[model samples]
Target: MQTTAKNALVSELRERIQHLEGGAVRSRTVLPFGVPAIDSVLPSGGLAYGALHEVAGGGSGTVDGAAAALFVAGIAARTKGKIVWCLTRPDLFFPALAQVGLRADRVVFVESDREEDVLANMLEALSYGGLGAVVGELVRLPMTASRRLQLAAEKTGTIGLAVRRWRRQTEAHDFGQPTASTTRWRVSVMPSEELPVPGVGRGRWLLELMRSRAGECAEFLVGACDDKGRIDISTRAGDRQDQTSRSVHSG
Candidate 1:
């Protein structure tokens, strides 16, 4: 049954891609993350063009939310020109973003008090097509608003990410989740898996593919991005071996 569901999801996404291609609608540009695993997951070797992608959480916290922002910004940072970022929250740490590869000079931050205004500005920038990408964050992401942004992205071929801010538990589950976007994902920090060494730990992420226009919903352990902005998969093997050695010693 799970395999059937995955096949169905893939079929649906392929239809959508066909429709776009038949119309000669191209994504104008592809956004790449410095990390290969992430880039491999996205269509066109990056996030879908002319679509709205969403990042939502189930609780109030900065770690997951910040990571999501950096993921989107990291993609834009690799593009040819500057990117636009609109935020309803004022506490965005620019320095942290820089550490993740977002160029300070390529970023344009617009601080707004209302979600509506922020969405409006993001749509406007997405339509221009001159920028690398457009990102926005709000406490809630209404399906209606997300549809509008999706249309604009298609027309302009700009990558759009609408991040849902952490709030009440109920709100986190249902607040304005994106509808028209090509993909919807939920990212959360998982307890780091144990490693052989007492002080060493292996990072893990609970990544849920809630929706995808060009693929099926799949879940995987997204490894952490190293300081150099690369995903290290081999590190997991070393950790597992260490854990086995420690278990033998304890026995």
Candidate 2:
């Protein structure tokens, strides 16, 4: 009789949970990166749609800024529909974005004269609900502005990316401030792999999940996006012997 009662209780609880999760499941859509090591650290094993995320470089140099831009572009490349890129300047190179799978034809670039205009355009694009993703580049993003962006994305089920670039080292510290983004990431360019024959191999990056609302934050050493905009763990990310042992064990 006790076993029977326990089984009934379990069934009742499961039903209640399913009822509660029905609406949540629809709102919390995900886009999986398909990399086990990286996905394991993120909630739902992927990046969340209907949310706003922030990405920044490790430093204030132009190269550092480019790394952050390309990283966001790669994410946008994997999304469906058209991509809207809003920036204060038109200095981004199209070839670099195309190499990461964000083709020129699929992207619409909006140049704004001021930072406020960039943020406004980004929020408007995210609210449209039809675009695959919206990316905004700004030197300073206040907490209130980020919250507005987040709310807009949640309402429209669109993905919003904020690329923070600073001209001075002191201004870079502003990135550490609080924001309403669902996730905050810092990407730094790493040395590319050296081929035994002649040319360079794929680029690598130190991707740091500085803050995340849905899961534990972590760091990863990952290769740059391939032709299809898919990322893979770097060959030198971990100890080779340890990886071999793990592979053998799993096998």
Candidate 3:
């Protein structure tokens, strides 16, 4: 049909634009999730390095946002070199980050009074390169701003993470808009894995891949925050199924 043809042309055009951005698809490094189920659906068989990725909590509450932030922490912990964390708030719990694998010694925190300052600092850190990753607590990631972030990452081979946290639920609507991020994710807290005895166990999360270029959307139920900050595949994953099909677009 004509509609399908139009869509194909649009897709091709986007690819061309991305290719011209100083990063071809094959030039970036890939970070595998280590779970076949999760990695299989990604276009690169893993998250691409030297790119910008978005992460937001499933809900507007602080708990949801914190979980999303911790997920990002775990990722940065696994990478090499130091991590630069730029944020508008000083409330990030260092002890919680340790529980997820990123220790204080490996992190450099940059505090800012404004969201725009935090984003500016993140862009600067990514441009510096040789760091593990640069993280920013963002309320809104405008398309133009995100493109700049992505370009900086691509040029420096650094990974950039925008952990979206908003003051109001209404502000969450902004996340629905498109960005130049290489990947977009939503993370929701789930029940902890059952333990052998009466005690707390490893946390669990329902991770949704909302948008990816040349990749299908997928949901993963996985155990969380190991000593090394990696979220392993939950044994319960087999019991669950994705509510949305692979063809689902941005949500």
Q: What's the lDDT for residue 218 in model 3?
A: 76
Q: Which residue pairs collide in model 1, if any?
A: 50-153, 50-154, 141-176, 196-242
Off by over 4 Å in 2: 1-23, 59-64, 237-251
Per-residue CA lDDT of model 2 for 210-245, tens digit only, reads 787857677777788876777877876342322112
Off by over 4 Å in 3: 1-26, 60-64, 241-251
Instruction: Show the lowest summed lDDT stretch of 10 residues, model 2.
Output: 242-251
TM-score of every model?
A: 0.71, 0.84, 0.85
Q: Clashing residue pairs, candidate 3?
A: none
- Work out candidate 2's RMSD over C-alphas: 7.9
lDDT of 1 at 248: 14
- The better-scoring model by TM-score among 1 and 2 is 2
* Model number with the top lDDT: 3
Error of 2 at 55 (Å): 0.4
- Writing each residue's lDDT as its tens digit, candidate 3 over 1-251 gives 99999999999999889877656653347888787887877777888889999999985343338889999999898899999999987888888999999999999999999888998999999899999999999998999999999999988888899999988777888989989998999988888887779998788888888898777787888888776878877786444765334545543
Per-residue error for 210 in candidate 1, Å, reads 1.9
Model 3, residue 39: distance off in Å is 1.0
